[model samples]
Target: MEDKIMPTVEELKALAIEEIDKRKEEIIGHAKHILNNPEVGFTEFKTSKYVSEIFSKLGIEHDANLALTGLKGNIDCGGGEGPNVSVIGELDSLRIFEHPIHDLTTGAAHACGHHCQIGSMIGSIIGLIVPEVKNNLSGSIIPIAVPAEEFIDVEQRMLLREEGKIEFMGGKQEFIKLGVFDDVDMAMMCHTSATNTTFGVGGTSNAHIVKYVEFTGQAAHAGGSPHMGINALNAAMIALTGINANRETFLDTDTVRVHGILTRGGQAVSSIPSQVTLEWRVRSGSNEAVVANSKKVDRCFQAGAMAVGAKVSVTNIPGYMPRLDNPQLQELFLQNAGHLTTKDDIDIIDNSHNGGGSTDMGDLSQIMPTLHPYVGGGDGVGHSETYLIHDYEKAVIQPAKAMACVVIDLLSNNAAKAKEIKEKHNYNMTASQYLNFQRSVAEVIEYAPEG
Candidate 1:
């Protein structure tokens, strides 16, 4: 038998893009279906099933029910042995009760445009799965649908935690602990954004810590024995005040963000409030700043308990690390994006641009080469009711094409580019080190006033 000749990288990319365009309608339809039937993190049973069905129809092999309602599929290139690249899509939606498209029963809505991510990921798979494209590449592609990227529904997630269903609050963190990414060498995922009119590359996100707080006090009759009970609701309010008071101390460069919501206020109107719970978050530009701000927030909680003569318990949960974008991956994405859109429409952000948001992709970046970029077809603010994807092609298909092209660039030529990235990459920590650091952040503190 004669040796077969392979196509050039550009030719492979063109073929992939054509395949994606041919399947554009189906991809867009899938995204719309997800938008109309949104599910919250770790509970995306319907979404997971939907993705699994699609994978099955495509003859792709995958592991379902990962990290609770997440899924991962593998596509072997059949070229040779090399690094495995992961194409990721988050499978959860935010809880926005007021959104017009929100699920009335669960208040879940695709307000963050995660639906588009799934679409793009599938589109990328469609492009890369052509026999010609696959045969020319030297590595594999892992298409992953991850759960709970929004980090909402803390109370329910905590309940799941207590039940031993999950250990970490964020899906990607749990995926890490479960060794889901153990075989992968690099990863890429594009997020939808309304801040730009075109695709964006390069940018860092804040590091953060999660806190679950409870204030306990005595209950008494509201009308006759109000003074006999300590006011837990009042304690919570005072804690908010304390938190606000310390905001002035937050340095501007540190990008500190301290905020939370009161989940429980009182049991009934007739009795004084005895128990109150809050879900709090502290974020900053760096890990050190996050730790410092977290301590300050914890002290504020204790201060509220001391002032109101109530007992308080604070459970600190580990959150995302700051995002670390790979330079080589960023350049590849930029080059490919430029091919699809003009320079004026695209913004190449510096590595230092702090997005003031957090993602578990940051955690993955600490241990491996990863790319977290943004694509625009969205309008209004992200994670809000007003956010909507107006251009499906730009939001989904374009990103898919760009990623497909990048895959070709990295893996088509005997995967020499991927090998180079792996060798030159200086990761911040190993997976084991990351797990240890997160575990150290988990702690419980109890406080009561001394008589």
Candidate 2:
């Protein structure tokens, strides 16, 4: 009997891309379906069920209800044992009430194009699981659909934390705490962008800390007795003013961002506000700057309470770390993307370029090699009503092809490239250290006016 000649790397890539193209309509339909039916963060029961059904149809074995509404599917290649590679898709939407496609009842909108992420994730799986492709590749492919990447609905998340349903707000953070990523060696995901370029590789995101604040005061009829009651709204306004005032002190390099939403001001306009609540965020280019600026903002909150002679409570929740994109993984993604589009059409961002945004993918990057590249097909501002995906092919199908090809390259030769990247990569923190650091960051500080 003659020994069979194994397929070349280029041949494997071609096979994967061909499979993705064959199912292009099905893949794009999934994205549109998700966009029409959006869910927010941990409350993504519908979206979770939808993705689970799709995984079931594909005959992928998976665990559901992870981190409240996450799904992890496992696909073992016929080639052999090797490093596990994760393809992640976020399964949450922003609460953009005015969005054209927003859910009327829930106000959830896929303004960030996370729906595309899910579609592309499924597309990549579809391509890789082809009999011819999987038979030649080593290692495993782990497809994940995670919830709560937006970090919104903080009050509800805090309640979840209190009930022990979750220890962290972000899905990836909760997954880390639950040891869901223990077996995974490396990961990659694509985000939808509205940039002029077709694809972008290499860029950093800010580290951040989430803040939940409350001020308590005495309530009285505003028109009847204005002097008899303390105003919590006034206290909140003062705190916001203080935050803005301190902005000048922040260095440009630190990229400090302090922003928040006043969730509750007063129940009725005729009465003084006895309670005021705010959901705030502090973001910076580095963890150190995030910590330093968080403290500064906390002091501003305390000052507000001091000025109003009211009591204040501030809860500091661990937020996402700055992104650290793996250079080798990025190069692989870029090469594959160039094949799908002209090389000049792709943007190569500097490693130090911080986008002033935050993502839980950053948390994952701290422990292992990760890629968070961007693909274009959307228009208007992200996380807003105007943001919408115009070309499903660019947003979903092309990314799927690129990611699938990258995985083929990594796992084709007994996962030679995957092993090489893993061995040379330096982790910023071990999983345990990361958990400890996040736990330490969780604390509640209460202050009452000194008598």
Candidate 3:
């Protein structure tokens, strides 16, 4: 009797790509369906159910309704025990009413191409679930769908926090707190982009803090005795102006971004505004800068209250940290991507390049090896009504194939590559340290003017 031979690593990669191609239509359909029926963070009940149904159909075992609307599924390769790798997909959309495909009643829209994330995540799973592939591979695969990545609906999230439903506003932050990622040794996810490159890897994002500010004053009839009333709206305007005035103090190297929206002004035009509320954000390339700039912004709010004899209260919410990409993991992804497209089509973003955006994935990256690459398949500015996915193949199928190949390389041969990467990687913080630091960032400051 002759001994059986194992498939070469290249052969296994080809098999994975072939499997993804075979299920391309189903994968693309998932993205299209999600785009049409958009749901915003934490309130993604319908979208969650849809993803749950798809997971069930594929015979994937999962837990549902996590962090209000998150889902986590697991698949154990029949080969052996090793490391667990997670593929993440965000389950929330932005509240863009003007987007063409937005939900009519809720105005929820996938203007940021998160729908394609779900497609590609599932596409990778499809490629990896082939009987031969699973039998030959070691360890486990985790598919996680997280909610509320957009961090909008601040008041509603505060209510949830008060109710003890969630302590953190971002879905990934909540997941970290809940120990959902405890077992995962490494993780990766692909985002859709409108750039010229077919695939992009690397680049850092900003660390930020969310602010919910309230100004309180006395209300009086505007038409009759306007002098008797204090105007909260005026105070808010003064604070905004003060923030703008301090912009010159910020350094270009810090990439400081301070912006916000006024959620409420006055109830009626005939009366002075007694209460005004605002949702503001402070972002920078480093945590220290974010903290320093946040203090400056808070002082401006206090100044506004002093100028108008109104009381101001500011609630600071912990936002995302700057991204930290793993070079070894990036090289693996880049290598796999090169197999799918020409080298010219891929973009290797510098590690120091900060995009001035923020994401919770950065929080996860601080503790483990993580990859957040981008796939081009869309046109129009991100988070805008005009943003739309034009090429499903590029956005979903290609990344899926590349991710599947990378996983094959990591998990095959007793997961030697995964272990090597894990051994060599240096974590910036432990999970407990991250949680402690984020919790420390939460506080409320109030200012009242002396008469």
Candidate 4:
């Protein structure tokens, strides 16, 4: 379609700089629309449809509702010369009772700014859709408007899995199971952040956290023989206490964090809780280290259960993977970002954000050389009700340009970078193996009926 798209490294940077500035209003407006209509996880029906419509208008071919609510759109702009890379943008929100822009359909808000992610991705995709850019290709640029990144309603998803509705616990993982990412090369994505880093910022490598620790125990009237009941609430509290006591064991650089809440402690305040589900998360510098710490954290639950004489189930559902920085991808992003910002002062977070939060992009990284950087959003805390667009135009525009710059460079740069990235991060997953991994996580988390 486009004259065998292959733009030089320099050309890629220049193209993004010139066009990104031009499309400023268009991209920001698109982001605002999505922001205004925040959709919850796995139910972004209208959002998916709207994204599909965008693809249709641009003449880009895409498939939607992958892994429940994920959307995948691809434009073969690299002219079959280099690696095929996917640009992922998560499209779900989590502010159920928080945020000014809340969606009534799902009682959710795009507090995490996932809505903005898809918008920036669309802007980047639009920039690549130019005839000259597409024809001068070096690799494939596929934009994925993915869903269910929040990992909400875990038990509901577990039931879905039991009924054979979905294979993976999360959207990206399900896409992986459906052979969605089995194709070409590298992938790039970004998030709206509050880290005070402007323009471009790369935080500490994130961990692939397994996100659960549930508890169950016998119930007895608190006023009448409380000792007779194996208090599940007590078990959960014991787990929390153990984790807090062990916090000092975590290395400073490792940045170990473990915290959770008790869901379903008991209906009546006077009753000893029959069951409690501890929604917990553990994050660290590396997935392996995080997993190791997660295991130790699990021991706390185990000890708590033992202390309370109640059975406990611990499930480690896949969360975000340890976000790694690829010298290859980072250089490309920096070079592109440098078109607007200087290289010497290109701010990069060496110590990663240990902000006690997690994401699903970690799974995508295990499969490819993915870059999930932070672009600015208005200066309010994410996941809070007060989060608002401080400066919509600048906040949305810079991120959009940064993403477009990366896509152009990846799609137009020589085949070397793309090829190496694909080979290096190629998903080493077998369907059976992935299924087993899911089952193993389930086994660790499955709650047993009261005995």
Per-model RMSD to reference:
1.3, 0.8, 0.9, 3.7
lDDT of each residue in 1-451, candidate 3, tens digit only: 9988988888888888898898899999999999999999999998899999988988899999999999999999977999998888998999999999999999999999999999999999998888888778899989999999997999999999999999999999999999999999999999999998889998999999999999998899999988999899999999989999999999899999999899999899999999999999999999989999999999999999889899999999999999898898899999999989999999999999999999999999999999999999999999999999999999999989988888888899999999999999999989999999999999999999776
Best-to-worst order by TM-score is 2, 3, 1, 4
| Best candidate (score: lDDT) | 2
TM-score of every model? 0.98, 0.99, 0.99, 0.87
lDDT of 4 at 6: 41
**Residue 110 lDDT in model 1?**
95
Whichever of 2 and 4 has more TM-score, that candidate is 2
Clashes of 4: 19
- State candidate 2's TM-score: 0.99
lDDT of 2 by residue, 294-410 (tens): 999999998898898888999999999999999999999998998899978899999999999999999999999999999999999998999999988889998999999999989
Order candidates by lDDT, high to low: 2, 3, 1, 4
lDDT of each residue in 214-245, candidate 4, tens digit only: 67777788998888887888887887888889
- What is the number of backbone collisions in each predicted candidate, taken in the order shown? 0, 0, 0, 19
lDDT values for all models? 0.92, 0.94, 0.93, 0.71
Model 1: lDDT of residue 139: 82
